[model samples]
Target: MFLRKSFTAALALPALASPALAELPHDWQLGMQPAATPVMVQIEDFHRLLLYIIIGICLFVLALLIWVMVRYNHRANPVPSRTHHNTLLEVAWTLIPVIILVLIAIPSFRLLYFEAAIPKPDVTVEAIGKQWFWTYAFPKDGNFQFDSYMLQDAAAAKAHEPRLLGVDNPLYVPVNKVVEVDTTGADVIHSWSVPAFGVKMDAVPGRINHTWFKATRLGTYYGQCSQLCGANHAYMPIEVKVVTQAEYDAWLAKAKKKYAANETPDALRVAAQ
Candidate 1:
């Protein structure tokens, strides 16, 4: 009976895995986060490609160094060969790096094009970066906007949100839909970034920059201000919740009502507070 119960529990574990959203860096995390979007998957693939190339180059250099130390040491050869230049060796080294650069350039350019080309978006959210917080507006959803502030120690704990990554309001989008985030700085320059989605664009003053991501999974993703803007730059956090289509629609409907634009900035700040 105990073995039977253990087997049943093992079968249920995979179902529970979906609800356990991924978190930020824990102790000694050396790898990139599990990708939640197609762009991130491509980013990881590119990274792996570069990693292989780097490892091969390092190993080749190490082997060459070991060969030199063994073959040309004073104990091994009393007289060193005075060879200043080898034409073939010089050409081979130069041509090999050029070939490697061409190999790396192909996928690098392809990925850049893919990231820059914004598809027909299902939703657009404007992220305005303030001094110490993010203010987001759902222009497509009746211009409903609100400020998102980082929750501190006790506040984050009570809200069940991750430390330094939790915000009072999180940007929401439907899973498998393209979400274009238009970014602009309200004061100084800040960055709107979410690593899981592989989206990051600078929020410049008097200019609108944009990036898009289509979340393939339903969960929460987090990022922080990637630029040093001010004293409380660390306090600015960005959170995104990818949900089902039905849930997204319901949430948008409620958010449209709850966060109307007619309210003054002070009123909105108070409401967010």
Candidate 2:
């Protein structure tokens, strides 16, 4: 009976793996995040073009070096070329690099504008970085706020997931909706970075930096502090949960009720709730 059950489980393994399981967190092995949104896709294409140009120039220079070593060696030419300069070669080298820079600059400028230019954001959230945790506030959504902290090792083990990277509270946003994030720091400098969304902005004390992204898929995306701010910098991770609009609204309503009571100390308001 045990053997038959094991065989059946093995047969069902393929079906059990869903789309979410196939798409893991972004890492260096894949170069960049999988291009899901339009901006990210364009950025990925621009990166590929830049990579090709760099590789081509490197290979051309390497080939020239190899040719010079073989054709102008002491045994091959006995006497070295005494020419001070080659006008054509110098001009070609300078002009080629200029053209390459132009090629790289055009797309780089476009990507910069795309990331910096603020669009009609569907929702806005404020992320404040503390010493070792993050506090998120949804000013437009009933003034809801929550504190997010990294999951402990024992908790992560029970959940069968990695520790530190997982958090207790995750920022929830609606899929395909533009989310504007205003980040600031309470104590020191921090960075909010999520590779899947291709959004990273610094959180400075007493000042706010803005960045935006529209999630193309509904899933939980994880990120960590890109800057070294404090002793527990590695412990501060960011988790974003993207859901449908209906689900987001439901969660918002619940969060508002839960946090609203604690936000105000008015006895009347607390009693009414």
RMSD of each: 4.5, 5.5
Provide the overall lDDT of each model, using Cα atoms, as 2-decimal numbers: 0.86, 0.80
lDDT of 1 by residue, 82-186 (tens): 989999999999999999999999999999999999999999887889998998877656767889999998998787788898998888899999988888887
Off by over 4 Å in 2: 1-30, 262-273
Clashing pairs in 2: none
* Per-residue C-alpha lDDT of model 2 across residues 1-273, encoded as one tens digit per residue: 999999999878764543242224544575875755567777788878988987987899899999999999999999877899999999988998898899789889989999899799899888888899988877667766788999899986665445677788778889899999888887899999887777889988767788998988877777888879889999999988889999999988888887775342232223223
| TM-score for each candidate, following the candidate numbering | 0.90, 0.87
Indicate the residue-level lDDT of 77 in model 1.
93
Judging by TM-score against the true structure, name the best candidate: 1
